[model samples]
Structure formats: C-alpha cells, structure tokens
Target: MSKVTPSNIEIIEIPKIEDPRGNLAVIEKEVLPYQVKRVYYLYDVPSSAYRGGHAHKEQLECLIAVSGSFEVVVDDGASKQKITLNKPNKGLLIPTGIWRELENFSSGAVCLVLASEVFDEDDYIRDYKQFLDFKNQ
Candidate 1:
C-alpha cells in the first residue's frame, strides 16, 4: 500500500442532491471508501485546551464534519500535519498509527468518526510522547 499523510488524508465529498425543498447526502459502504466497522460522533464539546492527544496502533478512521468545522492535527512520527475539515459532505480518512488531535471546533460542530475496528483501549496510544516513540520504532 502507499504511504499516508495529511495531504493524502483524502477530502472525500459525498454525493449531495440539493433542491428548493431540502437536501440529501449518501454514504455507501466501502464507498465512503472503506469498510466502516464502528461509528461515533463528538459533540457538546468545550474548547479542547487539550484533546485527542493519541494514536491508534491498528485502527483506521474517517472523520466527517457533519454539522460544522474543526481542525485535525496529525503526526506521523517524523512530521506533523494540520487539516481543516468543513462542509457536511466532506471527510478525512486517517490511517493507523498516526497521532491525531481535534480542535478549533466551530459552534454546533458535530464530528462523525468511522472506525475500522470496534472499541478497544489497547489499540489506543493515549500518551503523545509514547506515541512518538512507538511510531518511530
């Protein structure tokens, strides 16, 4: 497989049909473009001050700003990348083992995260320093 990066994080735009009456969006399995094994949303969040400070050992994720906008900071051991995610129909796909932080959320922002694995704390490298060291190794 190819390497992953903030630039390659893929700003996927889901198909949206707009009309004077309403709007509609669709997310097809594996066409959201990956197998989505878990789904979660982040809301009612206060200013990060500090947040997400971790990396996943094997889990992959796709983050969508379904309601508003926010920023995602990712570190790939030797380098760091910052991504701005907005637009309800767009998303960011994060590969395994990369450190990620979510912040700068706009009011009423609802972040939807789709994972490649089910809930498992052991897969999470929650300490920033530890993540860097582990990733480098």
Candidate 2:
C-alpha cells in the first residue's frame, strides 16, 4: 500500500442526481482508492462534543458529511490540515498512518464513514504521542 501523508488526503466528488422531491448522491468503489469493508455514521452529536481522536494502522477511510457540516483535522506527525465537510456529494479520503480529529460539528450533523477494513482494535493508535512515535519509526 502507498504511504499516506497529509498532502495525500483527497477530496472526492460523488455523483449526484437532482430531483424535485429530494437529491441523491451515490458512493461507489470506483471513486475511492480502496474497497470499502465497513460503513458507519455518526449522528446526534452535541455541539461541544468531538470525535475521532485516533489514527489507524491499516485501515483507510472516506468521511462524508451526509447532513449538516463538520470539520476534520488530519495530521501526519510533520504536517496538519483542516478540511470542511458541508456537502453530501463530497468525501475526504483518509489513508492509513494518519492521525485524525473531528470537531466543529454543526447541529444535527451526520458523518458517514466508509472504511477499508473491519473493526480491529489492534489497528488503532489512540494516543497522539504514540502516533508520533509510530510515524517516526
């Protein structure tokens, strides 16, 4: 697998179909660099609450704000960037070995995550110091 860096984080545009009633956006594997193995969503988050303060060792993820909006801060030990997710048709691809933090969630914001791996506790680095050590090595 290619190494993930702060500069490599990509914003993908999902296909959208408009209708009078509502709009629909489709997410497929063709638009992503990895095949998705898991899907999850975060909702009902309090405005003061923050999520995802960890880094994955092997899992890659695509995060989308399917409703409302939020901000994602990504770090690669040496560099960091903040990305805003306010549209349903856009996704941010986060690869392995990058630390991430979610913050600034608007009311009723929903974050949809598409993961490249199943849930594995060993794949996670929850501490920022440990993440830096891992990256340095």
Candidate 3:
C-alpha cells in the first residue's frame, strides 16, 4: 500500500435526494475507492472529550458527520491538517498509515464511520511513537 498523507485525504460528496418528509443521502461500496467491510458511529461525546488517536496499518475509512459537527485532525509524520465534518452528505476519506484524531464536537454530533476492513486489533497503530516508526518504514 502507498503511504497516506494529509494532502491525499479526499472529501467525498454523497448524493443527496430532497423530499418533503426528509432528506436522504446514499453511500455504497461502488461509490467509494474501497469496499465497505465495517461500520460504526460515535455520539454523545463530552464537550471536553476526544477520540481516534491512532492510525491504521491497512484499514481505510470514510468519516461522516450525520448530525452536528466535529473536527478531524490527520497527521502523516511530517505534517497535519484539520478537517471539519458538518454535513451528512459529505465524508472524509482516511487512507491507511495516517494518524487521526477527532475533537471539538458540537452537541448531538454523530460521527459515522465506514471502514474498508473488518475489526482487527493487529491492524491498529495505537501508539504515536509506533505510528511514526511504522510510517518511516
């Protein structure tokens, strides 16, 4: 796999359909760069809390704010960038080998994550120093 960088993270715009009742957005494996294998979400985060302080060795993910907003900080050993997710129809594509942190969540914010692989503890780079070492390798 290629090294993931802050500049390579893509913002994907999901298709939205307007209706009298409610708005709907569609996300499918066919529309993304990788096939979806797992899905999860984060909600009810404390105002002072943060999440996601690691990188994946092989897993790729798309993070979407289903409700409210939050900031995602991504790092690639050398540089970092902050991205805000406020729309349900937009997602941030996080490739492998890039460290990420989620913070500054608004009330009622729901972060939905679509992953490219199944849950595997060995695939996670949870330590910052280890992540840097892995990135250098």
Candidate 4:
C-alpha cells in the first residue's frame, strides 16, 4: 500500500479563458500529472444520493464540477478532509490509497472525471474495513 494521505490531495486550477460570450476552461497539456486514459461524468444525482464509497489502488482521478456543485470527503485511514467543488476551472486530484465519498450534489450537477486508467474492478477497494487493512499493510 502507498503512504498517500488526504493531505496529498490537491485543488488543481485549470486555465480559464475569458470571453464576451462566456468563459472557457481547458484541462490538457501540463495541467495534469498523468495522461488521461478514461473520462466519465456523473449527472442527474438526487440531493440525498451518494456515490464513490471506495478507494483506488492505482488509478489517479481528477474530479471537476462542470455544472453545479458537490462535496467530496477524502479519507486516508487516518485523516479526512471534506472538499466542495463548485468551479468548472477547479478539480480535486485524488491519488491512490485514499478513500473517497461523494455527496451533497446540487440539482443538475455534472461531475466530470478524468482518470489515469480504465475501469478495473481489481483496483478498487470497496469495503472500508478492507481499505483500512490495505492502508496498514
């Protein structure tokens, strides 16, 4: 297991271009540490609904709120931090070995995710107890 913690998580600022029509944001080039291998989004989530109750073993994820807002609680088996993502030009970068839970989504919220790897069930540590054991190893 890696020694990554919630403190390692970062709030990345994407380049935003101002225009008379509307503002534009970009997430490419040197903005990310790893090349994006998969892209996904979460939408139509109820306010009381929750998602992401697991931790990745190898994948790195960057989550951005493209529409509304949401909160992400990241835990490292020791410490935790709650982050609110409401800006399209900002993303939360989560490294491996940290547990994450997403909740408190506003209406019509769109969460755009950029991942470093494709979906793999083997890479996911779903059980909180199992994740704690993995962290101690």
TM-scores for all predictions: 0.87, 0.93, 0.94, 0.95
Ordered from best to worst lDDT, the candidate numbers read 4, 3, 2, 1
- Per-residue lDDT tens digits of candidate 3, residues 70-116? 99999988899888889999889898999999999999999999999
- Provide the overall lDDT of each model, using Cα atoms, as 2-decimal numbers: 0.80, 0.90, 0.91, 0.92
lDDT of 3: 0.91
> For residues 1-137, what per-residue lDDT tens digits would candidate 4 score against the true structure?
12234758888888999999999998876998999999999999999999999999999999999999999999999999888999999889998998999999999999999999999999999999999999999
CA lDDT, candidate 2, residue 113: 98
Report the number of the highest-lDDT candidate: 4
lDDT of 2 by residue, 43-100 (tens): 9988888999999999999999999999999998999988889999988888789999
Error of 2 at 89 (Å): 0.3
Instruction: Estimate, for each residue in 1-137, the C-alpha lDDT of model 1 and write its tens digit.
Output: 23347435666777788989978878887445567889999987675543588889888888888888889888887788888878777778787878889999888888999888999999999888898788668
Scored against the true structure, residue 54 in model 2 reaches a CA lDDT of 99
Error in Å for residue 68 of model 3: 0.7
Which of the two candidates, 1 or 4, achieves a greater lDDT against the reference? 4
Give model 3's TM-score versus the native structure. 0.94
Q: What is the lDDT of residue 17 in candidate 1?
A: 89
